[model samples]
Target chain A: MSHQSKRIILKSFPQGHPKESDFEINTIEIKEDEVKDGQVLVKLLYVSVDPYLRYRMKQVDNKAFQGYKLNEPLTSICLARVISSKHGSLKEGDNVTSWNLTWQEFSIVKGEELNKLPSNDLPLSYYLHSLGMTGFTAYFGLLSVGEPKEGETVLVSAAAGAVGMLVGQIAKLKGCKALGIAGGKEKVEFVKSLGFDDCLDYKTVDNMDEAIKKFCPNGIDVYFDNVGSETLDAVLLNINDGARLPLCGSISNYNDTKEAQGPRRTFNLISKNAKMEGFLVSKYGKDFGKAQQEITEWLKQGKIKEQIDERNGMEKIVPSFIDLFHGRNTGKVVVKIADE
Target chain B: MSHQSKRIILKSFPQGHPKESDFEINTIEIKEDEVKDGQVLVKLLYVSVDPYLRYRMKQVDNKAFQGYKLNEPLTSICLARVISSKHGSLKEGDNVTSWNLTWQEFSIVKGEELNKLPSNDLPLSYYLHSLGMTGFTAYFGLLSVGEPKEGETVLVSAAAGAVGMLVGQIAKLKGCKALGIAGGKEKVEFVKSLGFDDCLDYKTVDNMDEAIKKFCPNGIDVYFDNVGSETLDAVLLNINDGARLPLCGSISNYNDTKEAQGPRRTFNLISKNAKMEGFLVSKYGKDFGKAQQEITEWLKQGKIKEQIDERNGMEKIVPSFIDLFHGRNTGKVVVKIADE
Candidate 1:
């Protein structure tokens, strides 16, 4: 017996921003004999669409992470079910998550690369967001790098996004004043509902520096920067003495053909005796288990909330991925390919 | 007999770069009987003219250090000889250093504010450069903040200036490869003569990014940034993974009426997992004695060199101060107001 599977493949590298033309949907026939002794055939239930994928679309040397090879099937974190297995660990009907899975309806992966999920009361799609990489990114970036103190003010950019939403909640849990900057009124309202003390819509704010001053009366102490552009410049001007800025992401410049322009902030940093550090979640890989445990407890206690924007079918994958660059979706964007 | 002392006063705050007119020289007659209890009349020998003084010439709130009050006598670090004293500490003809002395030929200061220098074989001017604030700043900013390790490449900007010169030497002593960036051909030659592994004249270099790549084959591990402009941008592009940049000064932007313009570098910091921190030398006040001891030994062992750009008289002070902005002088700029 044989099955036909659809996969998203890169057609061309983007010059500025990625477009539908940059990708191609290809169908391939996979025979049952393709599942080797150590491999499992997985039917992807949910595929994660993240902002970091935009970085992978550019062809550049010395990238922080390796860029996807040309003409190869795109890969991402995915929630899948084992349709059949020839491996010792995985078996048919097992729900698992794999970080190295192809963005396709069906994938043949090594059993050792997949982690079988224990049955939980939460929605299976939650594993693609709040209980997954997005949650872990916010965990280590805010707690370890930002190091928000009990009474300090923590400001997060892209507040309506997956990582930013969790960062604000975690900051609130730690007894810090959580403030957020998002793109629109709806995002502002969304983040405010997540217990942020204040949420400013950057799209409507006339002066970011003045707005920040009014909201953060004591000045920003811990700035978890996600949108690195004018917001970052304004924060630099209003940072408290000895402030800490953790550079987690720069979604604003991911599509830039040239380097982003702004006020040089080294002088501001010197005057305030501040520190700015850039980091990736992979740097905290050794401690992911600890973060996952704490986040799970918070979710069960109803102290944390997860927002997911899910799309139906593998054909919607490119649209879902493209939507991320336009800030079209709030929270985590996940594409559901099949039933678990 | 009364002495007529000429002092420099801030005529007005500078809009951009300071000019000679922004400072006014006033001659004030000090009566011989003005020396009161717990006070001393001191003749200024050497007055330090530093780049940080340019920042003091601006009127702005939240200044890292207090700006000079308009229409008031300018004060700075000075070497002085106590002419007379009414305090318990017998100080007739005693050589001392005072950080709070007015920029003039004579200053009447509280006796307690003076630190009597012990008899030493080093030149009197050495106390103003290699053995004073400059040395301590380089020590703490490089060793403590930068933390350059053995065999790593360390780069310093404004390499012919006081702090930059010592930072490179200290890095070399720590077994790191020391590279320097200076302005003119002569300045580049000066730093190269001081044992820096390589030196680049930023003024003459056509492409700074290419120059950095050429000089730093292994990429920069530690960057002591003194001039923040194109040099900073170039270094950001070539920094090694986990690089550390200690922002000691931003002399290039001090004269600008508007904020300095450059490429936003937070993204680069993230990709490289780098850290940049700003600091004031005053933050390390408690550890000055230990640094002074080590620097004095290094100087005596001929492992450290100090360059002095001396101006002849108190009248030449304003010109000397203005010269720093144009990079007309190298190392420590000091105005010799009187014989030591």
Candidate 2:
């Protein structure tokens, strides 16, 4: 097992959009032979670049972010393979995903925080994608919070992106008319091909309200929101009675230093008997496998597709994460850290 | 049976706050022998003066304000007694309530909307209060939407006033420690005596968040919100995890021509996985009787107490409605159109 590890640490917190100046990559030496009992040495195969990670960089007293201490390695969901294990139940050559590991290589993790991935005749990347946090987020945010029903119209913002595409596909499987709002013609075509009934290029639309009304004549019944700004405001006005809004992530406002521009149609929630809730996938750890089983089957059956925008090598990791904020990456953004 | 009747008609739509100029009093001759088969002449006794009626005064394309056509009589819920009945189901001298019927000395009402008062001994005013729309709003907002649990903290803004008072009492009955926010010292004392664990005079408070924290150290579980400006912002900061906020009304900014200036905290719903929903009592009219039965039983057994701010004469109706915005009325505001 490799003892020394190279990891990215936050040198300082950025004001809004995280600058490269905020991060410092360093190689730390670890004595592998000094590995204590109940700990496994893992080689991180893939690291996730999520919008939520940007929130963790900010020091806010919020449940979603337990303040990211300065000069520390930022952590989210990382898929790692246990190369050598001293833990009771773990073994060598085991694939496990942990929500507590890093943006680094050679992570030492506790056994309790790790879950052994099931063996399937699918790509190992699916464990970090369609059958992972992104897929489970779509399931819980739509079913538990959004409470989507069959025959209802669902409008998803960032619909061609990783979580959004999965949300639209899952909602379609539930018999809902899925509408996607993306940034460009390519992403719009991409989401439409992924099974959304209609895909709108928000960049091309002059009037969002008219564009939304054209797609949802009966009004939006369920809103799976990933982008919350003017898009949320537009969706709010077209909501029907008893509409449910699941706040997945607000990538649109992640970089705003001050409060984001106030949404124009926030009062619509009161008038329409609508409700909006925010949730993190960590809250659904108990029921992850239940969603994983369904998502895995869908992936295996080709009912749900996986699209990864994989950047090569550990050197490209920071740029891949930064590209997420600039809307450059489509589908799941993962950095291939090392060989499988 | 009287052949003459007096009615109030809307001469024009109100530009802002409704004034005496917006309405006209008129007398019409009713043919006593021409009464329809399912119709009864009801002599009006009590007319409810609600804040929602003010919203109806401003012409708008909303369900609450369906925009009155010129020179038509304005109508709302009125507790009345059958003066004469051509309908076999209702006899003369029966106490009843109906949403239909003109604001007048006498008006004809169909049998469908009319409900005879419960024969069990209770104040006739209770029909306008703890047994009617006010009760249903509290029951559904607190029990169903707010979802209060025993020992969990419940906060009601405008607590001593109308729906807030009933909601606090109901929360108390459900074993929650209830807190109320009222305008004056008297109203705070009044709600305190009604079994609320604590009451804050929001008018006198220097910092409402500090005051609320003093009352609810465990953090807020359910917030029955009728005032939706700054108070809601304070509640947003104090909400516990998985809190439910049922937005009953926003009397605070109902009359403002401009959007109210307050900290918008819809984003807080995401961090706490909290839910905020706006509701109308009519949406749950199907279960009104079920809720009314429980409230009436409690009222009859002296398990709950109530207060009514009664103003005599139909001409005083405008003042009664205005009192709601001023937070001067406690419990229910009822206009005594005539002595029974």
The DockQ values of the predictions, listed in order, are 0.66, 0.48
The ten-residue window of minimal lDDT in model 1 chain B covers: B258-267
Clash number by candidate, in order = 0, 1
Candidate 1's residue-wise lDDT over A1-340, tens digit each? 5779999899899877788888999999877788999999989899998888878777877567668988999998899999899999889999999887898787788999998987879899888887888898899889988888999999999999988999999999999999998988889999999999999888888988788778788899999998888788889888998889999888888999987884466577888888998888888889977888888889999999989988999889998888888999899899999876
Model 2, span B195-312: residue lDDT tens = 9999988888898778777767889999989888778888888888888989888887777776555336666777888887877777888899898888888987788888888889
In angstroms, give how far residue B138 of model 1 lies from its true place: 1.0
Off by over 4 Å in 1: A86-88, A116-119, B86-90
lDDT of model 1, residue B116: 83
TM-score of 1: 0.95
Model 1 — interface RMS deviation?
Answer: 1.7
Q: Which segments of candidate 2 are over 4 A away from where they belong? A: A1-4, A261-267, B1-4, B259-263
Docking class of 1: medium
In candidate 1 the C-alpha lDDT for residue A228 amounts to 82
